[model samples]
Target: MKRTKKERQQLLQETISENPFITDEELAEKFQVSIQTIRLDRLELSIPELRERIKNVAAKQFEENVKSLSLEEVVGEIIDIETDRYAISIFDVKEEHVFARNAIARGHHLFAQANSLAVAVIDAEVVLTAKASIQYVRPVRLGERVVAKAKVNEISAARTIVEVISSVGNETVFMGTFNMHRSM
Candidate 1:
């Protein structure tokens, strides 16, 4: 049965509240309604779009806490960050990121994404990767969206340890642990 507008709106609010990253298309499919209806419902509820919600959450979480690198230098778009603790970034693999013949992404791109994220999570003005141990678990193809999560496992006055795991969907494609040196 089709849900009444008020009922659907209430359900939509609850769904989005549970998962702010839910897309309008997904909500539309779940509600058995048109995407336009979902958009209208969201607008009426004063809920921002996915991108806006992500930005808002990230800004609120990491505004002044990240001091190591500017946001633009982080290689991928940072979706979440808690300085000196954890960070998450997303990188969309395009044609340029892949090998022309195989359509498999170059390993360096994944490394850069993880490395930059590790650097970005430090709470110091000067941060550098003193060493890293990395492994590629699977081959990522072109057009894949890779999400990298970096968590700081240990921190000292001289150095910090950050572990980064990059995934496509639920499968981990790359993993790395970075030993970072922080100066001041």
Candidate 2:
């Protein structure tokens, strides 16, 4: 018996859903297909590679389990911290961070850096983004290390307003105000 590409893809998706950690080579062997074929099937189904799928699942789990600001890989680290304000760190925009073109850092990465820093400054176990108004003052070029600083501007029982500034060296690149809410 032979299966169509769609059938094979369905089987592959089922196999992946049952055991997401299964290797491509293992899946290929089980499906009697080449590794490249398995990869193509995954791509056709809009499924990420095994590692990426794992990371996605992990990110989802983290989001569900904690209310803290979750920075994606594109945003790097925490460089400095003040009592009510903190600075987040990021490396230059790279191929991985760009979508439409290689020149601009995707907006989500900028948001993540600022939001993460805002959450980091809050004295709470978990924080969630309620709203944000960001202004792209300047485009962040590739290879430019930037810093995002967030300050707690105001606090209420339900929300905290944070002011975030992102700068590359001495040049201000972006700025925003974020509303964060605590889960508990």
Candidate 3:
């Protein structure tokens, strides 16, 4: 028997509330609907996508506690740091991070993770991504944990260049160079 739209909407809300990190594909499968259908439902409900929701939550949490770093804002946590120009972070690839088949994470997540690390190393209150170049070396499988290390390669009066290296286990999965600008 087919369920009504209201029933589907209620089910979606319950599922999302229980696990806000679930992917659209997973929800589609669970609800016996198409991924596009699920997306439409989310749009109709004024619910942001998984990434946006995560960012919002991170922003809210950060606002509440200014002392703590918003790891979720970058979607990764700093594991180590060397002065104000270098740091390392670790992130796990989950369903919410995947946009396509297999365990490959969305490119934006990789970019954000690297960019956020570069920004975090700055002592200023505002930082922006000026430019970036990223190369995907290998596919990161779902549930695999990866490490991201960034270093300040060069710094000028207005901008800083940072290099990021990401690896899954011992194998290098992605690498990036980010140029960040600090505003006064």
Candidate that would win on TM-score: 1
- Candidate numbers sorted by TM-score from highest down: 1, 3, 2
Candidate 2, residue 85: lDDT? 46
Counting clashing residue pairs in each candidate, in order, gives: 0, 0, 0
TM-score of 1: 0.78
Query: What Cα-based lDDT does every candidate model obtain?
Result: 0.92, 0.74, 0.78
Write the residue-wise lDDT of candidate 2 on 79-156 in tens digits.
445434454455556777766655677788887778777776676676778888999998887677777877788878
Poorest lDDT segment (10 consecutive residues) of candidate 3: 61-70
TM-score of each: 0.78, 0.56, 0.59
lDDT agreement of model 3 with the native = 0.78
lDDT of 1 by residue, 102-165 (tens): 9999999999999999998998989999999999999999889999999999998899999999
The numbered model that scores best in lDDT is 1
Candidate 3 lDDT, 27-80, residue by residue in tens: 999989999999999999988898776556545544443232454566586655
Candidate 1, poorest ten consecutive residues by summed lDDT: 55-64
